[model samples]
Target: MTNTTPQAASAAESATAKPALIERNGIEIIAEAERTAKPRDLFWPWFAANVSVFGMSYGTWIFGFGVSFWQATLVALIGIPVSFALCGLIAIAGKRGSAPTMVLSRAAFGVHGQKVPGIVSWLTSIGWETFLAIMATLATATVFAKLGLPSGTGVLIAAAIAVAALIVVASVLGYHTIMKLQGVLTWITGAVTILYIILTIPHINMDAVMAIPAGSPQAVIGALVMVMTGFGLGWINIAADWSRYQKRSASDASIVAWNTFGGAVAPVLLVVFGLLLAGSDPALMDQISYDPIGALASILPIWVLIPFWLTAVLALVSGAVLGIYSSGLTLLSLGIKIPRPAAAAIDGVILTIGTIYVVFFAQSFIDPFQSFLITLGVPLASWAGVLIADVLTRRVDYDENALFDANGRYGAFDWISLGTLVVASVIGWGLVINQFADAASWNNWQGYLLEPLGLGGVDGPWAYSNIGVLVSLVFSFVVTLLLRRGKIRRQEAAPATDGDN
Candidate 1:
């Protein structure tokens, strides 16, 4: 007869019992038994979050760079996939480490040093979530106006509250709930988005679009940077968060493939279509500059506005949910002693406050806010470069225990990686220019090296070309690869903690 002690029986029961609807996992390594997620599972969240009609606004934004339809199309085609592929590469770390991205980053930056990037990651996530919430609220109010409802400040506030609440609830409920919700949202939003495209097809004037003049080479590069920063780099910090639940046995190539495919497919198609429409109509481009989703609604028939608005708002919420959820994990990795759900709620509250300020109080918020996020993207790309190098060099799986234990192999701080991040960011800032005329005066502090580098000063031909993001990424990556290979190999060979076995 098999004898099972009470302790064993209880443990077995706990393991076999259905997981709580609310996700309890935080920054810790996912338990092996629960790592049942497949590579294809990554498709839903990425696809749903990115399928928003707002991607079409990139068409207008790219054209604003003075690029022709063909040049803009080339930029979108190259930039979107390449950027998300970086995300895909980072996602490989998740399957290998079975922990949140920042947690796994401890391998490169050390336990204490990881906190530096962690703070940036947290702030970036919060900023992104808030931005999405603001967009959704505005989209809601605009749609209501189209529907002949009162779309005043009060309505905007109500919409903000509603959007914030929805994002918070889904994020707090956590991963499983989010995954299921994203799967459903993907179908709903995708179908509606397709309908939106079909309805707006007649608006595209191919001849006018073809007649648009081509921008300078520098302008093409600038448009490319915009597409990348707006799409992939925006989400790279949290790239691994969604994949942490993937089974350890999952193929890394598959992880990258699914992530890249899911994220790139929609944006590429949407942005190209948007380019056609915006290139054809200058007035529509102006409308999109101020209000992306609502402007798209302006082109559609009154009958389809409701569905279009609903899909756009839902898609925005889907993105905010992903951001808030990852931001919560990032919070915990920062040593915040709170449950994941509570952390998500905290970010949601912050998002709500930010939305209120932007919608109700701030004047000319979007341009500055966007420019600020893009500026921050320099450091983020630097961090990503360091982490990607570390991931590529280390052959063994992350020492899961060492990731949390400062005294272990990963150490308390990695000076090489941290130093690389700082240097790269400094150089990067000097290379990029803040093109937003309404941006804060401080933003002009960048591009200081422009004249020295002979790239023309801030007002030169390369002024719009944000080459700093790429420079930071490449510089940090190469430096880390050259310097950290030995350290990573030694760290990997170190003795595993008793629990790790």
Candidate 2:
């Protein structure tokens, strides 16, 4: 038998504890052989790519719908700053830890239990990618429709081909190439929109803005909840996903700062822009035109409008392809094991199906997302809350190997964290359900237990919807803290148990 010294063992443990990679250029990128090429390889490109992704095809219609310019601006101004602050705080951990969102799931879900959220992230990516693809195709067809072109199946065919080609190029070129193109398009989109807003400022409908609906507080709050879910969380919420590719290192604080600032500013701007144009009598499709392209056409000369509109379409498709490509990579990371090209092809096909359903078949743009938010979005958002709690309370930072290992520091199942998630989700959803139950029969339970608490019932704040994401999140965070605190008590009581045993 051989005996090892305690000092040697300690040294080995210390070496194992070191982080795998360092931060660079405000990105928490991994060390690799083939680096990002120059120009597009830098931070501004990455920043631009991210901004373009958030700047969408239906921005004008969605943000501007039903609200005055100032009112729409009010929502963006107030909502964005609050939401991004949370994202920014989380981004700091990602930058410092150099972990993807799924990788960070280990801390909250347990080493072995990570597969729960991992699969959720993967599935969500697939669904959202498909939805975006469909929307892009629809948007493109609408642009042609506005031009008095053929409004038949030919439009769908052309849009599909265009979107698929863009996705193929983006997937093959990978991050660096995408970012470079994103930088150029970002400037283009921004320039056109800013110019259009300035031009259209004179046409603002001040009275109509004041008349925008406040039909029910429940609906308004529900919409606000949706806004938060849309902005704050994503299928792949990892801050490091982009930052990991940066060329230089910055503090965790810096990453959070940039993410928060950008996130805060972008959505508000898009929504506010949407509101400014809300009073236009154009068709819904026209309202959400790829950008200010058609609107610009209305404002500018025929010669200039044609080129500018084309640029807007190019940028819009580029942004959509980026989403598809990113989601495909995320799917691959989830163990799809297919080559990038092959996976992108598969994603493109699925996206086509989703696009058709959303754009051509569906009556409303927000319906699918609303459904998704209540069912899938709430649970995933709950997962985020639990993760934040775990990171803060447990301090159970897994080493890289442990991140991959099923039975490392985490048990076969971290029942504590899992239990907290399940309980919080059930209770939160029950709040939504109890609202629709027969009121006269179960009125006591519904009104007394659920209504006042905003769970469910006639006057309940979150009735007829499975959207207690905020409530679930708050409950999950509280439960996690209690469990972690209980753990401390258990440790203290351990010696007493030994004596009793």
Backbone clashes counted, model 2: 15
Tell me model 1's lDDT, rounded to 2 decimals. 0.89
| Model 1 lDDT per residue over 67-101, tens place | 99999999999999999999999999999988889
How does model 2 score by TM-score?
0.74
Per-residue lDDT of model 2, residues 385-456, tens digit only: 777666565442234334444554443456777787777666666554432233222322322336656455
Scored by TM-score, the top model is 1
Candidate of highest lDDT: 1
Per-model TM-score versus the true fold: 0.96, 0.74
Per-candidate Cα lDDT values, in order, are 0.89, 0.52
The regions of model 2 sitting more than 4 angstroms off are: 1-29, 32-72, 213-219, 235-238, 246-249, 279-315, 318-322, 339-345, 357-366, 393-398, 431-461, 464-467, 485-501
RMSD of 2: 8.5
